[model samples]
Target chain A: DAGITQSPRHKVTETGTPVTLRCHQTENHRYMYWYRQDPGHGLRLIHYSYGVKDTDKGEVSDGYSVSRSKTEDFLLTLESATSSQTSVYFCAISESFRAEGYTFGSGTRLTVV
Target chain B: AQSVTQLDSQVPVFEEAPVELRCNYSSSVSVYLFWYVQYPNQGLQLLLKYLSGSTLVKGINGFEAEFNKSQTSFHLRKPSVHISDTAEYFCAVWNTGNQFYFGTGTSLTVIP
Candidate 1:
């Protein structure tokens, strides 16, 4: 939370419009993740970056894309925002896969109308 | 692949009472377990983690969890919970994979 920050803490967007959420970390963690939280679904991992330009899709990565050109930044982009995509999105950072735990950002609340 | 399940969706407890949140995971390989807490409209915070040895792990806010590999359970406990502990608790597992699997979460309510 202290080292990771997500931009546009709150956002309202129209359907079919592309939206991008940015996550920046000062701790220089090697791992970064994007997750979406919803009712009953908990936190679903959208995507994760292991290093610069090295990313992988998570369980729910169909409509989302991510990029990590820099170690300090990981961005999640929705191809076309939909009502189902309206949820609280969180960004987390970890030094390694077996590190202590993840440090999460405040989160971005997105509303699609 | 790894998956986590939180047995209880909600648990209501009186202040100063002891409480436990149950969690079980399904992973073929060795696993790393963790517990997280989330307040309203906030991100999840690390409560505790079980990376390797020592089955019993203590976390912040007087929270502790025990890792039972036999039953594949990692249950969180607090001898005396406070009102401030009222929040949503999540149990997660991360194997040697690309991402961590999280449970639906358990809503813990502390009554005064």
Candidate 2:
């Protein structure tokens, strides 16, 4: 409800395929983050962007890559998807460093077989 | 580095019963604390946050949390709960800069 949208709400793909998930925000927030949710894992940060063309890796960034070419758009790409990468991906936007709360997108459920 | 711990994996309570969710954090420097809730098939929503000031913080849906510096804990509580209150709760911590960490989460089920 924070004007955040994630494309391809649900996807099922075979292993070794390429997949890209899109997160678009109308709020133009300065900070954007990508996270993956798995059973018993809560949510693990995959990657994040501070601004356009500025990105940083998170704790679980091994199998994923991210790009933020525009302020409102942050993209997450899986070069070659694997069965282990199957999880619910969420995008979050925050206005400030630690003051305001984050606004999260609905989420994208990806299943790899 | 900052980390959060939610002790309970799942909690079940009858309707109108009081419930508590325990949360603890560890950080060398000062940190901000937050609580988030997620209903089924929905994204996480901010329940409440402790930035500064009073140790006790009240959030939406009749939920409240207490931030204890000495204890390194931020426990969430509600006096009465409804069946609609069944959901997953998360505890989070953030440092001065940009990184944010979340706990494993606790699933609360309100039984009738």
DockQ values of all predictions = 0.64, 0.68
Give the per-residue lDDT of model 1 (tens digit) for A1-113.
Answer: 69888999999999999999999999989999999998787899899999999999888999999999999999999999999999999999999875465898989999999
List the global CA lDDT of all models.
0.92, 0.92
Off by over 4 Å in 1: none
Give fnat (model 2).
Answer: 0.62
Give lDDT: candidate 1, residue B15. 98
**Per-residue alpha-carbon lDDT of model 1 for B1-112, expressed as tens digits?**
6778899999999999999999999874778889999998788999989888889999999999999988999999999999999999999887776457899999999999
In model 1, residue pairs whose N, Cα or C atoms come closer than 3 Å (at least 3 residues apart or on different chains), thus clashing, are: none
Off by over 4 Å in 2: none
Residues A1-113 of candidate 2 have per-residue lDDT tens digits of 56999988999999999999999999978999999999888899999898999999999999899999999999999999999999999999988655465999989999999
Q: Pick by TM-score: which candidate is best? A: 2
CAPRI verdict (incorrect, acceptable, medium, high) for model 2: medium
Model 1: reference contacts kept, as a fraction: 0.57
